[model samples]
Target chain A: MLINVPETVVADALRGMAAAHPELTVDVENRVIIRRDAPVPGKVALVSGGGSGHEPLHGGFVGPGMLAAACPGEVFTSPVPDQMVRAAAAVDSGAGVLFVVKNYTGDVLNFDMAAELAEDEGIQVAKVLVEDDVAVTDSLYTAGRRGTGGTLFVEKIAGAAAEEGQPLERVEAIARQVAGASRSFGVALGACTTPAKGSPTFDLPAGELELGVGIHGEPGRERRPMMTSGEIAEAAVDAVLTDLEPRNPVLVLVNGMGATPLLELYGFNGEVQRVLAERGVAVARVLVGNYVTSLDMAGASVTLCQVDEELLRLWDAPVRTPALRWGM
Target chain B: MLINVPETVVADALRGMAAAHPELTVDVENRVIIRRDAPVPGKVALVSGGGSGHEPLHGGFVGPGMLAAACPGEVFTSPVPDQMVRAAAAVDSGAGVLFVVKNYTGDVLNFDMAAELAEDEGIQVAKVLVEDDVAVTDSLYTAGRRGTGGTLFVEKIAGAAAEEGQPLERVEAIARQVAGASRSFGVALGACTTPAKGSPTFDLPAGELELGVGIHGEPGRERRPMMTSGEIAEAAVDAVLTDLEPRNPVLVLVNGMGATPLLELYGFNGEVQRVLAERGVAVARVLVGNYVTSLDMAGASVTLCQVDEELLRLWDAPVRTPALRWGM
Candidate 1:
């Protein structure tokens, strides 16, 4: 509703980011946002990117303790290999770079090619794929499970590790560990329209919701009659708990998909807490709001990551990003 | 979409707030969210609130450098005088308490009553009215201009002043100054549905937009055919710039009304920046996101706060709220 035109949406948004945040170096022509303090000597640099609509995901996350750089593609489309390669080269110190790629076909293929190109340029590159959405094993844009809210977890924890001067191998391992320990489940109350499409991506009936919905409006497990927040929380928590089976305290993210207000998200988080308590799941920390999103879809997703002491400490470390910031 | 029922929505969200922010004491029964470190000795306490649907306005702003306490009412309803009185008593140290009231009739009346009641209890009280909306001189809920995005500026700058151990008189003066120096204008592409109504609050035809929309679906200046983001920005910035006509650098807030995505907000912000630059308004800071909001309304508001050195310093102070946090 607030765009000048479909064709210039990404560029316009990039210009806004550049203007809003002078702390970061935004390359509008190349579609990359990099922390001005990039190429920190002997620090592992974390780089991530994907489609543009899921804000505060990659671009807004570029700061002191998060991604060193991010490549933003058009809405619901993966960034090309050039953007990733340029980002890696721009931010890579002699210590190397870690690519935090979400699990989508186009993203995975492009990041793989970018990794090879960066390696050819004598810059060490490592990749960790986040496929934590437990909704479906495969989806329209993904060969395996899709990446959803857990991308925030992976980037944050691993970014802290990198900021602490962890070697590339250790940083990559931490990112992969976070991605492995997290699982996500989503529900869509209404479909979101892409700028290019200019219409709802999928038809959602008035009185029903999509259970286990994908972030990009992909089909979920099934469509069901609207459920109470408690019922939805029970279903969502059960889905993640069954797959994750956390043996330690967990970090929880009650994420809104673009259009859901914080009022609804907080209410949903209360119900989520109730369900987790009933199941005896110890929660180490809880974050509620729209961090990862699906454009303007009216929905929410829950991501759970089992956290040990080390992971918890890293999670609590200082982060200064546009979307997520705490501590110092 | 995530509520258990219309009646339990506010209470349920309070429970969620309790779960999410243990640093804030959430009194579910009293509908007051207070910072755990309230009533700091020799420091003036800042208190504010209004309707509940504006999630982060008062509730999410409760922390060290923003609001000491926030009294949340039902959706689009004024918080009762009792809530404000209790909040004042609970948070008032030896220094006193300041109430930041929006200019809505209900809010003004209730806060006035609250101030008297608190003063009767041996607690000193001060009040500042925020009437920054430039849409109209009067509205359905307000006699003067309706308060909008500028409430954030008042709460933030004044909160910072109070945090600096300012006296009640000085803090009140700062808040009133901020409220007076700010101007706001909003545009809504769609209306928001209340939980109780279970439907759109007002009918906004698909191709039309409401210029200068109020926070609670109140009638605006006029309705017009849908305009591009640039056109909307021009109109919104002009409305504010004409009224403000600032001679100094400004702090800009491109706030989303509930359901607008960050993508659109950023794109709109770019146009806002262009317009401001062309108008010779030197922007010292730009914050783009949903700060003040209606419930699930697809819209955006522009707020301009003329800031001098002191006000800008207060604006840049450390704020550790759930919604707005920076510096340390």
Candidate 2:
């Protein structure tokens, strides 16, 4: 691991974030990162968080047109309810707050508790759970489908709605709509080693791959020998399209799982586009890079969200975050 | 290799770029990506290219405020002169063009030949060579320092100048100034495997790392047992600051070499900032992410460029590229 102390990984990263981006107020003590201009008077605030490994998803997405506050927990562990409640209190204005929770056992439980706590404090709170992973009905840490790459789409689109001064109810509806309309599938070429472990999380032989791996290295559908990018794309896209049965143009996300370079991800995306075209599916937009990730895991994930004109417009809106920024 | 065929890796990635970014006209056959709104009246055009592996370097950087055109060669090889000449002709308005060439011998030679060819065709051309890697005086691919992470800084600030309608001479001078004022040092935790070779580029045993490594796995100053991020930051910052005794504030770029995760990179950045503070160097701005890369090598490089007020203004200028986008 390229870290000084495994236990201090999240805190150290927060300090670095504070230094690199003075636009955000990083509370290392509480493990929350909030936009400096948070608590916009008449705007609904968006909050999302989970374990620490999947970066740029929650913390890096905190800015003007995205998350207002992100609570990062220890690596692969769910954040406590206190972090979420504190983030809500810090960012919530009179307009209320929305919590975007990924559907993991611990995260869902913790966020549910935080929502109750926030409401007790007289802050109106709404919740949207993202469970767009189509790989399994249940996983190691999830009762239902695991939330994977589709969380990015939900955050981005819903964030735009919030930034435009939509009420908390409308923003929650948009977030839920995005989560329900999206599907994701991941394949792991190799395992990731957590800082505390100092070794591979799972045994993934060099010549084999996990076809539908979970983000936390959970067991997937099956193991297979190495496949070409085209083959992998065909399987992944088919997995997503079959389940989604989208009637509208889809936004495509070709995401890297930490260690996969853009070179390979872009090549894979080309194949993915070919497969989608063959299926006569129109792609509204395509994003190719790492957004959601496992720590140094060699793999890639494909996420597709069926978007309406309104959702597409929101996706195109200006955002000014650290990891994802444009149109500012 | 996450590609259909090793020989067509670059082509496949280009096709994907064309699909992803409609604002950039990707010429797969010509191996160049140009802004769709090229030949912007009196604006000086910025052109850059190199081997395809260091992605998002030249190609992902083509947009409104960055390079006007980018030519991509096969992995680990310099682009030919024809591509550069073609790009020059396509984007050269009456205001002329500037070529940002890295210091690899093949790149320098090919760009030189292309500059002469473009001049013969009645196109005004200026050149700035980036040789900012302070690891070794000479290495496997160059006679002087190797061009690495500092290329991002040069492209950004110089591209800002070009976008502001600076003459070709001024843009070239700014680029040269940035290249001269910058220093970079890299550390590799592991070796990268190229698509063509389909094997590790070099041997890096477990529990070991290479300090002062080049972007392409070139031999570094020494190999030692793996060090903590703080220790590594101390050595890297020392290497850069010792050679660049700047009297002005510096912009810091903590760049990932493909396989390193943001989690580790941010933790490492924290350590880097501590060292810079201890050394009493004020940082005007900092960028953290993968801008330049070597396939999927697990490592990072730190780049520091001294900045004056004008240079800082240019650096803060809006850039709307696929990779680096802000202030737009």
Encode model 2's per-residue lDDT on B129-175: one tens digit a residue. 99999889889989898999889889999999999999888999999
Best by lDDT: 1
Residues A1-328, candidate 1: write the lDDT tens digits.
7899999999999999999999999999999999998889999999999998999788999998889999999999999999999999999998999999999999999999999999999999999999999999889999999999999999999999999999999999999899999999999999998988888999998779999999999999989999999999999999999898999999999999988889999999999999999999999999999889988899899999999899999999999989999987
Alpha-carbon error at B141 in model 1, in Å?
1.2
lDDT of 1 at A321: 88
Show model 1 residue runs off by greater than 4 Å: none
Stretches of model 2 off by over 4 angstroms after superposition? none
lDDT of 1 at A59: 96
Scored against the true structure, residue A131 in model 2 reaches a CA lDDT of 94
RMSD (Cα, Å) for all candidates, in order, is 0.7, 0.8
Candidate 1: the clashing residue pairs are: none
Candidate 1 lDDT, tens digit per residue, B1-328?
7789999999999999999999999999999999998888889999998988998899999999889999999999999999999999889997999999999999999999999999999999999999999999899999999999999999999999999999999999999999999999999998998999988999999879999999998999999999999999999999998899899999999999988889889999999999999999999999999889898999999999999999999999999999999987
